[model samples]
Target: MKNILLFIALTLSVHTPLKGFELQHIVEPSASMISLQTQNLCHSLYEQKGHLVCLPWSNPIVDTGKISLLAIAKTNEKGLGIYQRARDKDLNQSFLEEVFRNENFQDISGFAEARALYKNTVFSIIPLHFAAGFKLNNPSLPEVHFIEQRQTQIKLSTTWFLDNPLTEEWMSYFIAPSIYHFDRASSSGDYDVLDSATTPYKDLVQNRSLKGANADLALGWSSKILWLPSVTVHGYRLFKESSDCSTCLPTYISLDSLNAPKADASVSWTIDHSFGSSVFGAVIQGKRLFKSIDQDQSAFAYIYKISRLQSYASLSQNQRSFGFLFDANLYQLGIQYSNEIQATALQPKRINQSYAYTALVL
Candidate 1:
């Protein structure tokens, strides 16, 4: 993992996209490239607004403000012409989904090379699995305070980016509304009702599993500008139902940050907000400093995150959650990594981790 991260850091670092053009436009400039960026951002904003105010909207507020990134050679004719192959410093998750006509371009577009598609895009993603949660009830709820298992019960799920994007510019909305399906496992392997000393739970844990289906919808700015309003909505329930678990609250989260991503290609920022029954906390994450042996072949970026939560929710308190992503590529082969922190209503509080397999196009 460390090696791959190092490689990506190196690959993206020295190959400054903006450094190529002439020194006329502010030390370095590409007039045509700039036009393309301005046009696209304008078109994107118009399209995004249409999604919200039109017939049937899906998610959030507004999308990106237009910004000129490059100077492109205009072709006059149009059928998905290459207006420009621009680069964005802080493309957020949602915008990436919006702009990429063909999602999964990040995984399929040959490692971020400037690709000109006649309105064509290629995309894919490494599947991922996650399981984690923490309990927040008063410690006194349990007669025995000892954790049957120190680890929280892990739930798992996997997804392929059907229409994935490499850069956030492809994404739509201040918070684009996108959907994906997931399966959640029981939050704990341990039991709350029946124990070894107890009759029912002891018998159940022997061959027990907690599993359910979930549908997730994301609402956040495609760009990573901080202090922006963002949100998410998820609907999930066990395949089977019981009296105690029937009315369980659904999951929701909101994040708002003001930090911009690093322009040096060596920094990242993360902000989070989680809502659940037992866990309640907010973490402000930071970027890890980027370092690369080869500034050309590897892309290094620093990342930082902050998380602070009560871990126990109630009428007054709420839950806080977190997620992390890391990846790198060497030549063509590549690997990806991801992590998420969930807090739920349980004892001892739990945390779940996740992993992904990455493939970079040659």
Candidate 2:
């Protein structure tokens, strides 16, 4: 009896720990990759109107007074994984340190945009605007084996405004068609025969190469309410086939079918003062107005701008972030801190993230 009890105790100890590691491998790399990719792609941009708008739908003509050329880079504390240094001063030793780092997961992304507005337009009394940009997202787990993920997006868009774009009360509309491609490879390492032969553990390896194209549109209107504070409303939508939308934005992940078009709306109140500008707003969208698959469908923001400086802070069901930007005519610098929930093997964990960016404005 004593020998049998000892054998059982040893078996439990070995198998339990191994099982935990196996479970972690199952949801790792890919799960972390998806979380980072979605956040990077959906990050919003700051607008003069004091509203937070997604990068793809931003109206460059209004955001920047004239022809604009901008380059921006973002990264976390782990190091630069997306935008590498132009020239490495310590190439040999630094390269070795990067490979052996015990980074469980990391996200790196960046983008560049160029835009111009043409006056005396044939389309409308306002101006015809054109913008083009590209984005790249890379997330990885350095210590994990056989793990790789990358995504690239290209955007080309045009815009038309009405009722004098510069006026206090105005409206604008824009359309953008974008294309993106993503590649991912991940595995759970060599599985033990006991686990591999199990019913649900047979398929623990995945290699996917996918591409998608989507057409997006947005309509925005702002007016003085009772000649007091100004109010702005915006509606945005995306059109795509169901299969192609397997990896759509977080807002659309909960849709039963992508064939049914869905749109999101946001409303904000702006107060213009001698000091600067202030805005408060909330976004609403989808069948699940409160929560979505990975995050809350609704979001809120408060922004204040004075002179060439702006401060932004936001809140949602599961995330909070704060950031500030300084505009020095031809140059801009910004940094943001984010706190959000991230999925893990056993449970959910809260992640504290930081982002720093710089841009040159032409």
Candidate 3:
């Protein structure tokens, strides 16, 4: 009689609004013994179940006239050890679900950042900007905390814009110099470690402190045509550095492999119509554009602004994000949501994150 009652309850739970609270059970009745088994799978099936969030931050470019100021704060948390493996294997949603079923999911790793920037125009043709930011990443879970990093950055830049009379377009060039500091600490244990003897520069994988200066450069072209988009190419680490400090980053990493110079391009189309402004573009960052799509951090983005309301969406490698912004004369408020793929040594895990930010025009 008890076994029959339990089966009836299970049927109701699966069909009701509490269907997600699925329960599976087995009941055996024998002459001398009764056996019962039960399990609740709701928590295992949901993502972001145990994550702790504190309003992260993200933003879109806002023209704040001659002088502009912006500030941002954000935090991201995720259950580690999801896709901590090589990408060579074929993976599907069902496979990921099965793997997650066996995981003791917990918020074991994440990062937080605080940033601010100031910008102004010089002689109505040169743009000058200053920015500084700090980021911290400390994971408490030993199973996933293979590396912890803290970073500090400060940058100053100036841009020169010149108009082309023949082409009726504008060409701009910018150079930014920055001072950066970082401390990386790695676990001595074998768990979740990416460093191996076979891997190049394995020695640099352990605990280290580095601080140095580098510069970035950008060249851009803009036209008045609706279909002819603006194009910008950015180069990081465009200039070498000289650091005498003991903890300064070695030239090998800065000039050679790890932090070698990198370049990427962005193309954006802007149309100002009766409704407002619509901008859409793509940023591609990789050595190979089409050959290895998965290895690139390329992204397609679109933004629509009708007066004080702005909406944006972006889709990129293993991530999708969308957000909305409201501009109120002096201050702007915005919020965003992102579903990202966090790469790890054991496998690649999917993480859901959110961000909120506000900016002020000074």
| Alpha-carbon local distance difference test for all models | 0.21, 0.39, 0.37
95-135 in candidate 1: lDDT tens per residue? 43333322211100011112111111211111222212112
lDDT of 3 by residue, 69-166 (tens): 44333334333224343254555666555544433222222122223333322111111111111111213322222333233444444444455666
Which is better, 1 or 3, measured by TM-score? 3
In model 1, which regions exceed 4 Å deviation? 1-175, 185-215, 218-327, 330-362
lDDT of 3 at 148: 30
Ranking by lDDT: 2, 3, 1
Alpha carbon lDDT at 99, candidate 3: 44
What's the CA RMSD for each of the models?
24.8, 15.4, 21.3
Clash count, one per candidate? 87, 0, 11
Q: Where is the poorest 10-residue window by lDDT in model 3?
A: 30-39
For lDDT, the strongest prediction is 2
